[model samples]
Target: MHDPAPMPEVQNDEEVPLLGAQRLGFSAGSQRLIRDIDLTIRAGSRTVIMGANGSGKSLLLRLLHGLIPPTEGHVEWCERPLDTAARNEQAMVFQRPVMMRRSVAANLRFALSARGIRGAERAAREAEAIASARLEHLVNRPARVLSGGEQQRLAMARALACAPRLLFLDEPTASLDPASTHAIEQIIDQAHDDGVTIVLVTHDAGQARRMGQDLVFLDAGRIVETGPVAQVLDAPSSAAAQAWLGGRLYLDPTHSSQT
Candidate 1:
């Protein structure tokens, strides 16, 4: 992986879209998982993706983050093709974050080292990440031995330590306690305040309202609605979105849901 370039200074123009997908799609053999998705994510914006169990939320997030190749269409970063340099500027945290057998501090150091950060700069970043995630007490503990919440926190801190310009999280707070969830959200909030663009996938309506400025609702591999968080959650126009926000199950007659 190439060393990530320094994040560009935020321009005054918020209208310029930072990332985009044109007719994005993914499939497993004959089954189409994600259908044609056309979306734009503005720089420094907080966008949330919400959907039912098999609504292709996580798959879409993976496509946008370039973790897996799409079967069709393309993703763009800063008006250019999504390439290694663009991916270097992005990071992702999964629902169940994988941790090294090494200590918490070691895990963080490894990530920074991979980014070519070293010596005093690396030390500074490590210290900041430890503090930011409040992992000082557990720094010496084996990362894999930490509680679910601690491991998740470490995963988030490790990602942030690399100074990614775009952060993608897939149900980061799922299965975590309220307190732990709040802690993670606070860290995400801080990152956003520091000009990191956030793209999150979540099933929690409350979390969506708390962390999202823009909302995208997907169902049966297709986007049903896209709008401001409040507008979409409070007054969703699409039948699929309405059923989801209304706490009812929505099954698309035309498409089979992917699990």
Candidate 2:
């Protein structure tokens, strides 16, 4: 097939409707993973979604990314429905890096190619991504054989190579060492600076404090509270949020500070 044409650019900051979810919910059989999640990711906002392990943080990210369909309600970007065109302008990194059975450099090249990038431009992007991830020495190494931290960095760089306008990360540094975590954080910061809107899901309070401009706290599949990071993290109006920040995990709403 011939090269895919470029997607029309979002005209301006205002044109970027960002991400919006209305009455979003997801259920498997009789159990609901997420419910009534009404949220909006603003243009260029470093929004962090925080909750306990089973609070559906990862599921929520997948729902918004359109990787999974919501059992109820809808998701939108740039005021348009979440469809192929919208998804094409975004990228996602999961908690566990999923690498192809190929060299690190080759993996990045594939990601770029999928986005219709080729020729000298593709090589340039692949080179820059490799350098950014500090994987110059591992260029020809098989991706799946890299150390855990190295694989995660390669995953991040691959997503960045797509030149996405929106980025969704589901605890990308969850199991990484402090140094590796810091490197990923720096890459995220640079992506935001380069005009990528970020939505991150993490349980690490320290990460939230360092990168969150806004916070959305979830408990038992519901948003307990949301506001500027300082307000929500420091002075949460919801007792459930306070307790979670205090290291208390409650899967049952009745067990939460707020009923």
Q: Estimate the Cα RMSD of every predicted model relative to the unseen true structure.
A: 6.9, 8.5
Which residue pairs clash in candidate 1? none
lDDT of 1 at 156: 98
Runs off by more than 4 Å, candidate 2: 1-16, 251-259
TM-scores for every candidate against the unseen true structure: 0.93, 0.90
TM-score of 1: 0.93
User: Which residue pairs clash in candidate 2?
Assistant: none
Model 2, residue 164: what's the lDDT?
A: 91
lDDT of 2: 0.84
